[model samples]
Target: MENIIKVKNLTFEYTSDEHTHRAIDDFNLNINEGEFVAIIGHNGSGKSTLSKNLNAILIPTQGDIVIDGMNTKEEKYLWDIRQTAGMVFQNPDNQIVATIVEEDVAFGCENLGVEPLEIRERVDSALKNVGMYELRERPPHLLSGGQKQRVAIAGIIAMRPKCIIFDEATAMLDPSGRQEVMNTIKRLNKEYNITVLMITHFMEEAVEADRVIVMEKGKKILEGKPREVFSHIDELKKIGLDVPYMTELSQLLNKDGIKIRTDILTVDEMVGELCQLK
Candidate 1:
């Protein structure tokens, strides 16, 4: 797969009179085209900061970040990088600018100067993609948390970005709402082939990813397939991160000398392991 994003020796710092706070320190990463990667970390782990830099919302202090071969630091590539890697923030209210759902979805395309006719098509298609087309005329503020988030995603899709960086997009949503958003994300990656870089605190949400990256103190501490990374129950716990529930159950079974696989990440996998004992 082609590399859609590359981060080399990246460092980001916030300086004040009191002291300098480094949000990202010497972080290095690469994301392949059409890949679904979830990043997990506790507060102040630099995950959110890294996502901001990917879309050129925050410029790097020392290193370079290239998205789709466009360096984020270059002034000329700013809009291009942002267009290529759209962002969906934690709060849907913050992302929704227009009063109506369809208008909100078209906002990004309008900013891009897309033709009115094309914008209409994009808005309809994007809304349908996120399953929000039926409520096109509804006011955003009246929608449920999940519905609002879907509208926010449609807005990003209208921009036609190759990748979407979701910085805790589901954090404020209820479980049902989170599932709705997660399903939309999966469809976007699997059907539309959009690369997905999700920065989230939910361990269950991360389990569906193709790969998981663990961050701590502004550095990459672990990166691997979901099963492989979640297998490190102890290491993740040490950093105040939790593994998927199934993985935890498998680990407990192993600790009790039951001797099952430690990498089980889903309920189906646990059932399979238990059945294998017969």
Candidate 2:
């Protein structure tokens, strides 16, 4: 698979009133095409900052970010880079630009100068992709939180980005809303073959990803398949991060001498492990 995103020794800082704060410190990463990668971190850990840099919302103070072969630092590639990697922020309301759902979904395509017919096709397809086609004619403000977020996602997909960076996209939702967005995210990666870079605080959401990246104080401390990374329960806990519930429960069980598998990440895996003990 092609490397869609590459960050090399990237450093980013915010300067205010002559005081500089390093938000990302020599961070490096690579995400493959069609891969679903989740970034988890405590507040001020620089996950969101990294996402912005990847999308070229902020340039690197040092190092480079290459997205789909386009370097984000190059001024000429700014628009193309953004088109290649669209962003969906935490609040759906902030992303919705049109009054009606379908119009909002079509907004990105229109801005990209897609023809009228193609824009219509892309908007409808994007809405259907996020399971929001049935409500396309409704006012966005009337929809539930989950539906609104899906509309926001639809807008990004309509632009046909190769990769989507979701910056705490599900943070404002209830459990059901989060699940709705998660289902849409999985479908986007698995069926549509779109790469996903999700920065989220929810451990369950991270567990669903192909890989989990743990960050702390502007640096990546851990990166692996979800099971491999979450297996370090103590290390994650020390960093103010939580593993999937099943992984944590299994660890406790092993401590109590029950001898269950420590790598369990889901309910089904835990159930299977316990059944073997009987």
**Stretches of candidate 1 above 4 Å error?**
none
List the candidates' TM-scores in order: 0.97, 0.98
Q: Model 2 over residues 25-132: C-alpha lDDT tens digits?
A: 999999999999999999999999999999999999999999999999889999899889999999999999899999999888888899999999998999989999
Model 1 reaches what TM-score against the true structure? 0.97
Q: List per-candidate RMSD values in Å.
A: 1.1, 1.0
- Model 1 C-alpha RMSD to native: 1.1
- Model 2: lowest-lDDT 10 consecutive positions: 105-114
lDDT of each: 0.95, 0.94
Worst 10 residues of 1 by lDDT: 225-234
Candidate 2 ranges beyond 4 A from true positions? none
- Model 1 residue 168 CA deviation (Å) reads 0.5
